[model samples]
Target: MRLLLVEDNLSLADSLTRALNQCGFAVDCMHNGADADQVLRTEDYALVILDLGLPKLDGLEVLRRLRQRRNKVPVLILTAHGSIDERVKGLDLGADDYLTKPCDLTELEARARALIRRSHGFDSAELTFGPLSYDSVSRVFSLPAGPLSLTPREHAVLEVLLMRGGKAVSKDALSEKIFGLDESSSPDAIEIYVHRLRKKLDGSGVAIVTLRGLGYLLETRDAAA
Candidate 1:
């Protein structure tokens, strides 16, 4: 497996790199979020171990830009900030997992493996529907050329639809899947995410067709063509 370790601490980076390498991973170590963001655009890695504090940029920004570009590589955040708000913010921005600083190497390795396994899809990695392709490992939905940029909720909505193939998905289902029990969301809010997604995929050779009583279904121009 290939992994990127982005930690400003050279010593910690080296240690993590060595440990991951020993566990049969090809690890690329870098310092600073600027380099991490730059390298991430051109390279594909199974996972990214990102530290929040960096000299050039914050790891959260690196992650935000990553998701904005529609890259779905799983990210495991490493930080000294273990506050509830910080962790929630990272997750909200698309981080797959988080590890507070001064953690155990064994736990980190285990989390890495789990994220990779889920992403690469031990069950199903890549799913295609007409002109769109969803990579389970990277969690990126792509057109022919590259990944599809989407907001966090939009990504979640599309993922549920794609996973269902041609089956109808209700607004209630979308709302439930994207919203947490502790969070507030209305059924109308689900419509907004779907509308935004529909606009983004407008000319992409596929369509999110409304099914009236059923909900919405992703369809190729010619369901029978």
Candidate 2:
């Protein structure tokens, strides 16, 4: 999935970005809230990690404008302050969750997964289609035969499709979700990942199908047929 991280602490941002990237999320970082607000206005992200002590614009204002525009992207707020009132205010302003600074990277990752799953309407960590199953916690894809082996890009592509369940995902949308701003992205690149995933999933009873003008759809073999 794609995520936007807004934080002024360069060191902390770098660590968090690296950790989240390792977790299979394509992440974009902004150092201040103004830039963050501008980015959010145009791009779609699965989640946002907002640090409240941002410069140019504070995180609360960014969140307020985001909600004012009716955007429902999940947000996890981070701040140096541990005041309950601040936490309550952020929650009230549409922040999906909160973490005090000096937070655990492990905890941040877990919370990120939860927010993403909740946004996608998944009530649990596991998502299944036909014989294929995925564990959000473990970030593993499996079949009855064995675990599915995938490169990082391939894993990301499959995750997006499975999250959509049966919905169509355009190549552009897929690219957005899986490629960070710094990474090179193209429709052909997405196709390559899908092709690779298809090879890996052969005879798994689930399939990724191309629908002309409708983008890509993941479904059981029966549904595709």
Candidate 3:
């Protein structure tokens, strides 16, 4: 899944970004609320981690504006403000959850998972396609051989394909989702990643099919052939 993290504290943001990325999320980090707002407006996010203390635009306004547009992507407010009133206000303003600063990263991840699960309307932790079983939280892809741990990028690539299951996903689309808007990674970089993924999935009975000029599709070999 993709997450937008709007935090101004450089050290905190950097640490949080790494932690979330390690947990299998493609995270886009912005140091200011204005940039965060722009990213939210332009990109699709599975969840947002927002802080109230921000530059350019206060985080509350960002939440307000997003709600004004009826954007329902789950927002988990993270702030130093732990007052009862502040917490109530954030919830009233449509935040899915709230976490105080200096909080445990594990707890933050748990909240994120809960929000994402609620947003997707899915109760199970495993996503299955044919013989493949993916655990979104653990970042493991299981098959007949046993569980295989994936690098964050590999997980991001597979997550998109698996989530769409039977669809043709364009290379450009995959690039954007995996690398974000300011991607310096070339199309060749994406191909390299796909090639590695294909080899891993090859002969494993889970199909990751390539369609020249169109894009790539993931399905059973029988379905594709």
Using TM-score as the measure, which candidate wins? 2
Model 3 Cα lDDT, one tens digit per residue, 189-223: 77777888887877777877878887888877542
lDDT of 1 by residue, 94-207 (tens): 999999989998889878877876774544456788889977546678987678999777887887677567789888766654553335679889888888998888777888
On residues 119-192, what C-alpha lDDT tens digit does candidate 2 reach at each position?
A: 98998999888889999999999988889988988998999999898899999999988888888778779999
Score each candidate by Cα lDDT: 0.81, 0.91, 0.83
Task: For candidate 1, give the lDDT of residue 117.
Answer: 60
Question: Order of candidates by lDDT, top first?
Answer: 2, 3, 1
Candidate 3 backbone overlaps, count: 0
Give the winner by lDDT: 2
What does the lDDT read for residue 45 in candidate 3?
82
Kindly report which residue stretches of model 3 are placed more than 4 angstroms away from their true locations once superposed: 149-151, 180-183, 210-214, 221-225
What's the number of clashes in each of the models?
Answer: 3, 0, 0
lDDT of 2: 0.91
TM-score of each: 0.55, 0.96, 0.83
Candidate number that wins on lDDT, 1 or 3: 3
